[model samples]
Target: MSDADAAVGAEVDVDLDFGDDGLVPAVAQDAETGEVLMLAYATREALSRSLETGRAHYYSRSRDELWEKGATSGHTQELREVRVDCDGDALLYLVDQSGGACHTGYRSCFYRRADGSVVGDQVFDPDDVY
Candidate 1:
């Protein structure tokens, strides 16, 4: 790590601003390509685990539990860097993606443009994996 990065990391003492529901939005991005892969919610425990293990972890509201990215599809995201927004209410996870990030087999969750134009090439076949 660069001296600057090391210094920033050493200051991992910010109070995470969780919402009233005890959740925060965590956005995951591709470290190299700078593509935003996905956005998921994280609880305090999930955030701690991600910081601890250097992997992308999230709390699924649907499942009501912690889940590591790619645990089932083998498309794990290794943590590269983590950043909190100025307000400390949001998180950014820069990760090295092993496979596609989206369950729909796209490289990013932002597959469709707001204008309804489908974007991004499919990186994998979801059927083959999940």
Candidate 2:
């Protein structure tokens, strides 16, 4: 294998502590701005798919299936790198996000505060897309 391939293999081979449900929480962040985009769950297969495809893939708890981000909305996230937390129970995905990251049309899922006030602008209209 090429040196780059070997390095990726070494990184992916690490034992991640997926919980009983075989899922790990993955935090997606904007690679350029360092802004957190969204939080989602991922299966081993999802992680592998993300690395292999260079796109963000996540397991949907509600749908009970795997999905590629922006598969329908066209707000795809281009995966740049993945980092495992020290406990190996969580993942950080650095990506180049296109358009809005939140399905609610916001750039991030954290657009609101504890007071239910909006702090971020809506990048798109959910009605138009979804």
Candidate 3:
């Protein structure tokens, strides 16, 4: 392993409190702008992979597998740092994001308010990308 990988591996050794399903909620935020990008679940393996690879990895509940963000859409996230919540049950991933973070072409998953207002910019068309 490279020095960077070793350092990440050491960092991933922290004990996290995974839920009964062996998963924890992970929130991804733009490191520079502090924009909340997306929220996903993570397995221990997924967390390790994110740290080891310096990229975002998430456990897809619908797909029932682990996935690297932007593996297909090309909107990848470069992980800057990870912060654990006080309860150790959640994680915050500070990342440098490229392209829209939302699959629907929005910059963030929380593009709409409870009233359903179209507020966030549509960076790309999903019909063309997906």
Best-matching candidate per lDDT: 2
lDDT of 2 by residue, 1-130 (tens): 4322321332485779998998999999998889999999999989988888778899999999998999999999888788999998999988889999999999999999999999976999999998
lDDT of 3 at 26: 98
Estimate the TM-score of every prediction.
0.89, 0.91, 0.91
Better of 1 and 3 by lDDT: 3
**Could you give candidate 1's per-residue lDDT for residues 1-130 as a string of tens digits?**
5322322222367877897998999999988889999999988888777777777899999999899999999999888778899998998988888889999999899999999898887999999998
In the range 1-130, model 3's lDDT, one tens digit per residue, is 5322332543754669998998999999998889999999999989989988888899999999999999999999888888889888999988888899999999999999999997787899988889
Q: Where in model 2 is the C-alpha error above 4 Å? A: 1-11
Taken over the whole model, the C-alpha lDDT of each candidate is 0.85, 0.88, 0.87
Q: Deviation in angstroms for 55 in model 1?
A: 0.8
The residue ranges of model 3 lying beyond 4 angstroms of the native Cα positions read 1-10
Q: What TM-score does candidate 1 get on C-alpha atoms?
A: 0.89
Tell me model 3's lDDT, rounded to 2 decimals. 0.87
